[model samples]
Target: MNIYFNCMKGIVYKELIRFIKQKSRFFSALVRPLLWLFIFSVGFKTALGLAITPPYETYITYETYIVPGLVGMVLLFNGMQSSLTMIFDREMGSMKILLSSYINRNYLLFCKMFATSIVSTIQAITFLLIAKWYGVDISFLAIVITIPVIIISSIILNAFALFLSSVIKQLENFATVMNFVIFPMFFLSSALYPLWKIKDSSILLFEISSYNPFTYIVEAIRFSLYLKFDIQVFLILGISLVITLIMAFVGFKSKKVNHG
Candidate 1:
């Protein structure tokens, strides 16, 4: 048991060290979400009149409305970024070494997920602090409540990335998957606006948003930020995590067989 714990600790430490060593990567991870919150949200605040959501007694600025989405964006991108790093590691032969360790593969993967999720969640909280400095009203408790949700969301996203890595077989293919998968997931979800806002324009788009996992993630964060719980968010996130983990497991298994 002690040996297992030490292996997990080593995995987490390696991830943190790698992330810190790559200063450029850390800055890049931070930049996109900041742009959305500061530039885009500021410009759209007047143009987009967001209605009062629950826990908000009166109408709020568009910037406030999309803050949760920006947090979600941070997690979403970071999760994918973790996947990209994994691919890079595999190409550099580091992943093979890690996998060749006597430690359990599933536990090793979980440690990877946990480490990446911690980084992503930290970025989200940092983004929130910056937003608060910009005059966004957020309770201390809300910030506390958001931690687990961000962690879960990050894990789900990382699992998806792992699944993608298993299928693509090359680091070069990651960019293509990001373009095809991440962008659409971000834009189509209620991350930028509420589902009711979309309903005003087209029922189909609204319905699509309702079904998207990203939508639930945004909603989950939005609710948590208000110090509330959304059961549906828990349900969707739980199910997505299960499915993505299964896919990742299958992918890892295939990789093992091929290498063997």
Candidate 2:
């Protein structure tokens, strides 16, 4: 147990050090979400008036409705970027150190997940604080409760990213695949727009968004931010947790092929 704990500590510290050194990463993370919040939200609010619904006691502006989804977006992007970094490290032979350090590959992968999850969760919290500072109101207690949700959500996203990193053959090709994955995942979900609103416009889009896994994550956070209860939130998370574990394991097993 001590060995495992120390191993995690070393990896997490390395990740933090890397994050600190790369100031651009931190800024970009902050800027992307803020742009959407400050600029895009303003444009959309006038174009599309919002309605009050579950997780919201009052009629919310586009900015308020999208905050939770943007929070998820932060984690989603960071997780994918982190995976890209791993792919680079693997190509550059940096990941060889982990193969040698830990006797088991799974623990090493878990350490990677743990490190990224912590960093992602911290960023989510920072995003929440900034959102509040921008005049988007949410309960303080709900923010406190959001910690666990962020942690789990980050882990799932990070684990999912790690699995992608393990399968994607080269670092250069990652960008194309990432765009293909990220944009659809973000736009098709209830993140930028509400599902009810989507349903009003087009039944086909609403049905597609309904089956999207990312929508559930956004909904989970959106509902949790207001301290609301929804069993579907937990049910979705539970299902995602199992799928991520299994899929990540497959990625771990396929590391050799990924390198080739």
Candidate 3:
């Protein structure tokens, strides 16, 4: 138990240190979402007004409607970025040494996921604070409640990214793969627009977004931000978290064996 605790502590501290040193990562993560919030929302507000969404009791401005989605964007991008770092570490042989250290591999991976999740969650909370300051309808209590949700969401995203990292071998190739995965996932999902709107526009896209795990993640955070919960959203998030973690573990083990 002590060994596991200490290992987790070391990994988390190392991730935090890295995050602090790479100031660009912190700012970039915030900037991407802020751009969507500050620019895209205004541009789309008149053209794509929102009705009373489930989490929202009354009609909301496009800005409010999209805040949760932007939050998910932060998690999604940060998760993929973490995966890119893993690829680099793997290429540099540091990951090999760590895995070979023989601390239970799954536990070690969990520590990495947890560490990255922490960093992602920190960035997310900071974004939420900035959103609040920018006059979004976020309550202090809601932000407090959102902490756990963001942590869970971040872990799922990080696990998914870790699975990708385990499969993708080269850092140079990761950018192409990230683009292939990230843009489609973001644009197709409910991140930029609500499902009903998508349904109105294209049934195919609506169905796709319906099945998207990222959509559920965004909805979960959306409901939580409004001091609400959906059993359906929670169920999807739970399933996704389990499946992604399993895939990530299998991915790492397979790659490690192949390397060995």
Q: Residues 27-128, candidate 1, lDDT per residue (tens digit)?
A: 787798788888988788878777776757788888788889888888888888888888887888888777877777777788888889888887888889
Cα lDDT tens digits for candidate 3, 51-151: 78788899888888889999999999999998988888888888878888858888999999999999999999999999999899999999999889998
Clashing residue pairs in candidate 2 are none
- How high a TM-score does candidate 1 get? 0.94
Give lDDT: candidate 2, residue 65: 91
C-alpha lDDT of all candidate models, in order? 0.84, 0.85, 0.90
User: In lDDT terms, how accurate is model 2?
Assistant: 0.85
RMSD of each: 1.7, 2.2, 1.4
lDDT for model 1 comes to: 0.84
Candidate of highest lDDT: 3
Higher-lDDT candidate of 1 and 2: 2
Q: How many backbone clashes does candidate 2 have?
A: 0
Residues 116-196, model 2: lDDT tens digits? 888888788888999998999877888989888887888888888888888888778898977898888889999998888
Error of 2 at 4 (Å): 0.7
TM-score of each: 0.94, 0.94, 0.97
Runs of candidate 2 with Cα error greater than 4 angstroms are 100-102, 257-260
Q: Residue 206, candidate 3: how far off, in angstroms? A: 0.8
For candidate 3, the per-residue lDDT at 141 reads 97
